[model samples]
Target: MDPSMEHLLARKKSSRSSSRTRSSSASSQTPSDQKPREEKSAPYRDPRYETLLNTKGVFLDTCDLDIAVESKNIPETLLQGNQTVPESTIFGEHQFEYACRNLQGRNEARIIQDISRLLVPSAETFAMLGSKHLEKVIESVNEGWNNCIPLTGTRPQPDYSVGFRREAFSNEQLDKLSPFIGNWLSGDLSFFMATYYMYFPFLSCEVKCGAAALDVADRQNAHSMAVAVRAIVELFRLVKREGELQRQILSFSVSHDHRMVRIYGYYPVIDGKDTKYYRHPIYTFDFTTLNGKEKWTAYHFTKNVYDNWMPSHFKKICSAVDQLPSHLDFGVDPLAETGLSQELESLSTAASSDIPLNPAEQQVATPDSSLCGVGAAKRPKKDVCGIASDCSRSVTVNHCASCLNQINAHPASFNIFASRPLR
Candidate 1:
């Protein structure tokens, strides 16, 4: 028998025996007791109540990047073809090659393995229910308020506000520290759009608030406020534990200014140390206007909440920014650019397919033959768009044969494909 096969069989036997023991124990419980037992084992148990357990260092500091790239050999398959480059190779000008070389090395590969081992478990826990507790609490509070208010007349509104803050990581630092994170930002578009929509509203809301303050009369409101505050704190703690909180975040505050309510805050870098206070950029949000008067409002909730309240706001922000139009155009598209016509050609071809496409079409239209098969396709010929051939006859054009074949295979479909208007 093969030694590896024997080991696997032995492990399977042990797992089966252990599972049987657990099953038997569970079966022995009384019907009444089963609920409690299940609750204890339930995945939804509050992660806040659990201790801050460091799984793996998904939140890589500069030092970790150095170690991952320098001391631990890791492969940068995407950046470079080499598999034996140091993780620190990103610090070098020839980062892609360094990453590729390191990727070939066994020692460097361990760094990603270690990161995966740590990140996967923690992510699972966070996904299960660890992250939602705060949202649930907030929802409950909102529901409670709704129940207490009278529908017929103008009821007294509660004086409350919420603010958020996040720390920043430099582009250089992100490049060196975790290129995977950078890659994720580059690859995901919807993630960035959602973030933009989310924060825009909140910032707009805070702008509307514009230095207003609120007052609470009874102890009950104060207690409810305290509960909300505690829930926020717990949310932060959970984010920290899950390795989601970034060093920078957006912070928000809600207050009253006598007659009108207000919300205010800023996105700022959270000082790594305890001694330094929250330092915000000069541009803070104060959304006090609604038709030029103060009224109840909600801004981009997700972006503000994630930026301010979640510890992993930095990561989220980075991920979100990666999805932004600016980042995609500058960062990923250049490296991933095959050529103009090819990209348009791909889009033209994709549009012909029966498969439903994203409503927000990100793919650009290009000539089928011009794609380099990397990123965006090159723009079509000026002449094709009605420009005279004499305008730029000297300009060289390249097209991809494979993309042309695709277009040729479906000429009827291609002819019908209309060019989308540029934004």
Candidate 2:
């Protein structure tokens, strides 16, 4: 070979060697030295109690209730007549003893079932009783209140929830009221129509056991009770009674961890244009602390809520409904007369079939949902009517200023309900 050709070949070989050395050095570099791979951002986590309060621009403060101080402070009327078990006997004492004796399993469902079977009154048993007032209210297990805070896209399903039975109100009355107050104003008649028609829900209970933290229970109760109180406030607002609370305690929520139970009263403070929800301590009972003597304390409280609080709540709702103008000032809904029945049927059919009108906006709890986990996935942007169309806010051309304001505030509800057709 020529000497010049041999020199070129050696130089080419040297260049290839340098390239291999550089590649090897890059491969062996520390993570810090290497350009990092782009990470897909984590999904937005679900809002807990405090986070929910901040996000919705609501304030949370605590208050002490007069009746919560002592068992004697409970109204005799509340403690007496309408109880599932006799007022004199200790409620759930035997079951409490049994639970204490057995090595209680950590299964959340079993814990809740045991608690419900022993402590909480079943809707069937309570309703079957001959009592005048008790028969009107019922309890639901693991059913989410459909008419939750419009701002929160997902509904917080409590372990146990209570509301008035639909039979308590006449269909004709609901029919007349559904036109003006239905749709987005879930705080009104639509709440009952939206979910299982468990009208005017006033109480909820959250149960936690085993590895499940009571803190998570509190957060769940907070979101649920807030929604309950807000619905009450919305009803009052319609009747021009929004700011007229004789007592701020509008609703109640109970948190249970085996033998430990805590009760909270939820209320709203209207600060100018915005409404703020506050949680007040009602009572806390630990059956283990007093050698099971205080086992009946929670029973008495629940009885009072069922007997006294429920009647008063129902009365207020009736008064508000009576005050609604027979003819709505917001012109006329084409579906007013037959709307309630048609909508109720449609909702029931949809619920039974388990088919959502729009799957994108459905509130589904992911399996991985934990103490700090994300809830229902983020939904695609919806139009003013909540449909996947290009409907604009200006489409509220027919809606009154007051109606428009409510629509703007609770876009989620309007999106869900506005598209609902009446027969």
Candidate 3:
């Protein structure tokens, strides 16, 4: 070969060899050796994750409760029943004797009598006893309610919850109304109240082993009752029954320890632009220390709540459902009236306290600009990426491009409560 041509050919061969070496090195790289593509996280924080990671549980004090007051007056609904306690009824002669005997024998050691023992019953023995005794009373008065269902997997899973079945309102007219009624509530009529099967829970009970757990039980009861009252009020709000604002004690909660039982009556009232839940002390008594006369009063009160109060409350709920207008006069956003966006808050974020304990009411941004405008393509479900509205002080982000669209959109239904869930 000519000297210049040979030199050019040698340079070309060196270039090809370098290129192949670089290609081989790149092809042999492992995933660990390669740079990772950055993964963008959801914009809004998950309330449950925040709760599990950041929020600390603390027992709430009486003063820490929203609109809580100390009172001695028994609510009228609780005293409405005129039934006399018969010997066969719970806490009466026969039943009381049976309870006392059941405490004897080897189980006598488990019986909590001393105030010291009342401070800490073994495991949940005191709570179990309280539940058993209350069930007896419920059986005596449970005409067909068939409630007293225990709830689980929630922040305020009370020892007992009393609610009606979905079929209670499953009439032809209601079925027709469900579409309209369901819009005001969660998308589904079945899970509108709380869960898929339980509808319109009127009362809840949280039992504790001793006085030590009494405050915790009270907090749990307060949270549960607040949820129940809010659900009812929101239902009525949908039908625009402003007059039927929950002034009367609509929801009740029973909290008891080994020694004493406390009943609280809850109602909601409009304070300025915010809905406020009020907890009133209905009656507190020590069943163990009380005589026959006093003990029967507790039984009478329970019967009145189950038989008299609850039936009336359930009727009111049914009436509201029936009054759901067949046609829409104007487009009413169900969440608009309550200062919530059905699309902003999700079910998982509803773990916060529904009671607004602070001066600043929780607010969700319902911007004028909606992705689901006329003739616009529907937006797919997006993972919620915003602050949990529990005591949300202010909202600057009016429009979330990553969030759900308005108009028939399935937003995560968050609790409208103003504070984090009280431990």
Candidate 4:
């Protein structure tokens, strides 16, 4: 019998027992020639039954069922109910609970399956997004910061110094900026920070140091850098199409010894194409740290243009990464080309050959001990029929030994083994 059917049968049996117990306690008084007592004297039944009856319009001022039926909203009514009859009561709570539980389980299973199917593709999409952001940052730096300006002992020097301080925007003021400008920059920045912090919490201080280095006294250079940053931010905003324009500089510090300036800030990101902004977790990493410790490095900005916009651009990449689906399994049919059916057929044929034919064939073959061969030497005389022996009854059949050994030898091969059992 189907497991589901068995479960339903068990539920029905339990419900019937409960119903019998409930009915057994009712008064056995019979109607007689005498007039009935006052209406209030009627025995009270379960409130749940009253609720169900009321819900069915059998005993209430209003009911969803009556509205649906009278309005011809529903094509059919599967349940029948009346006020006095227990079996006629509609909408049993126990049954509804059971159905809800079952439906919830099914929905959870489907969601898990969908996530598994999406995992790898989502990861690849995120990687591509990161690559595009990186490329844009590189382009911005090359176009905006090809020449260096002198910062120390300057006499009517260049307009911008590499390590000078520039004005910074506050969260409230940043929000008041142009929507496109603010959202594009701030959202991307938030995403970058979230990704960084999730992977490298210790790099928070270094990030502030790097951003501080970009603070310049030269307004022209600062404007140019901002423009470059804006362009990259717009690219990501256009693609994601969601997220907030809010920005908050968590901290900012300068480090002349390392020729680095760092700033830590929070920005939102486009979670998907529809939602405007989603605030991701925090992140922190330094571009200068990547120069020598390449392996430990989280991100790289080859040119100063990228360096200026790094915080926001990395936010886009991180958003893409976070949005990735957690699990995936492409619908590649393992049985289609696995040849498992043919292998099973061969095994079945071999097992069948051990079974004795009719009486005539058994008499002709007669108990040939020598023909059993060395492989069967250890077998008992009555069990020399090879596959004819009921392996289920054997104490040492080693049903999973060979498969387990193969899995141990080549771990990657487990995918195939796992697929086989599923088939």
Q: Which stretches of candidate 2 lie over 4 Å from their true place?
A: 1-49, 57-60, 63-98, 103-105, 147-151, 180-194, 210-212, 332-423
Per-residue lDDT, model 4, residue 264, is 23
Worst 10 residues of 3 by lDDT: 4-13
Worst window of 10 by summed lDDT in candidate 4: 4-13
Q: Order of all candidates by TM-score, from best down to worst? A: 2, 3, 1, 4
> What are the models' TM-scores?
0.20, 0.62, 0.48, 0.16
Q: Model 1 lDDT vs. the true structure? A: 0.24
The sequence of per-residue lDDT tens digits that candidate 4 reaches over residues 158-236 is 1111221111223442232222121111111111111101110111111011232223211122222222222223333
Cα lDDT tens digits, model 3, 354-404, are: 322221221111111122212221234232233344443221122231122
Instruction: Evaluate all candidate structures by whole-model CA lDDT and list the values in order.
Output: 0.24, 0.51, 0.42, 0.23
Clashes of each: 87, 2, 8, 38
Regions of candidate 3 where Cα sits further than 4 Å from its true position: 1-77, 80-154, 170-173, 176-192, 327-407, 410-423
Candidate No. with top lDDT? 2
Error of 1 at 58 (Å): 11
For candidate 2, the TM-score is 0.62
